[model samples]
Target: MKKWLLNILQCIQDIYQILKEIKALYNQFTIVTAHLQTIIRLIENYNHLAEEREKTVDTDQHQREIKLLDIGQVMKILNISESTYYRWVENGELQPRKKGKRHYYYLFDLQDQIAKCKLKGRL
Candidate 1:
C-alpha cells in the first residue's frame, strides 16, 4: 500500500538524520579531544621546563637559612595576585607557614620560586 511505503521512507529518512547527527557529534568530539591533548602537551612542556630550570642552579644543602615574607610583599616580588598566591598555598604548590593567625612565605626559598613562576601581571 502507498501508506506503508511512505511510512518506510519516513523511517529511512529519520535513520539518515540520526546518523548525520551522530557523525557531527563524533567530529565535534574529535575536535574537543584534540584541543585537550594540545593543552595537556603544553602543560607537560611547561612542567618540564620548570623542572629543568629548578635543577640547573645547583645549590649546596648545608646553606640553610629561613626568612618570612608577607602576602603583599610576596605578591609584589613575584608579580602575582593574592588569590593566586593563596591558591598555590592551598594546592601545596607554594609552601607557606602560618604564624600568629597569618600566612607567610619563606624569603630564602622565594627567590628561586619567583624565577620559576616567571612572575607575571601587574599585581
Candidate 2:
C-alpha cells in the first residue's frame, strides 16, 4: 500500500510538470498571435493606402506637370499616416525635399513608388 501511494504521488508530479510546460507554450503562442495581428493590421492599412493612391494617380496621370506636396497634403493624397511616411523616408524608400522647417514630396515619385510596391505584391 505504501509503494502504491508513492507511485501515485510521482504520477501526479509528472502531470503537474506537463501542465506547467503547456501553460508556458500557450503564453508564447498568445504573444505570437498578438504580433501576427499587428502585422495584419499594418498590411491592411498599406493596401488601403495603395488603393487610394492608385485612384489619385489615375486622375493625375493626364497632367504633364507634377506638384510638390507638403506632409499634410501628401498624407491626405496618399491616405497614409505620418509615421508610415516618415519611416519610408528613413528607409530610403521615399525622399523628401526639405526647405527650412517644411518638407515636400514630388507627386511623380510617389506614384512611381506606389507602382513598385504594387508590383512587389506589397499592396
Candidate 3:
C-alpha cells in the first residue's frame, strides 16, 4: 500500500509540472497575440495616411491646372521683379502665351518649374 501511495504521489507531481508548462505557454501566446494586433493597427494607419496623401495630390494637381495667371500675378507669386521676369522670359526659361496682346501663364507650368528648382536646391 505504501508503494502504491508513492507512485500516486509521483503521478500527481508529474501532472503539476505539465500544468505549469501549459500555463507558461498560454502566457507567451497571449503576449504574441497582443504584439500582432499592434502591428496590424500600425499597418492600417499607414495605409489610411497613404490614401489621404494620394487624394490630396490629385486635388492639388487638378486645382493647379484650372488656375491661370498673368505676368504681374506670376511675378507676385514668384516674388521676383519685373526685370527678372522679363529676363527669364528672354532667356526662354519661361514661355507665356499671348492672347490678343495679353500674355497668359498656366499656374501648373509655373508650379512644375518651381518644384524642379526646389529639387535642384535653387529655390
The model with the greatest TM-score is 3
lDDT of 1 by residue, 47-100 (tens): 999888776543422223345678888888887788998898888777767788
Model 3 lDDT per residue over 67-123, tens place: 578989988777678898899888888888788877788776687667756777655
Quote each prediction's TM-score. 0.46, 0.50, 0.53
The segments of candidate 2 whose C-alpha lies over 4 angstroms from its true place after superposition are: 62-123
Question: Candidate 3, clashing residue pairs?
Answer: none
TM-score of 1: 0.46
Q: Which scores greater on lDDT, model 1 or model 2? A: 2
Per-model C-alpha RMSD: 13.6, 15.6, 5.2
The positional error of residue 104 in candidate 2, measured at the CA in angstroms, is 25
Model 2's number of clashes is 0
Question: For model 2, how big is the CA root-mean-square deviation?
Answer: 15.6
Q: Residue-wise lDDT of candidate 2 within 14-97, one digit each (tens)?
A: 999999999999999999999999999999999999999998878677442666788898777666688988898899977888
Model 3 TM-score?
0.53
Query: What TM-score would you give candidate 2 relative to the actual structure?
Result: 0.50
Residue 105 in candidate 3 has what lDDT? 82
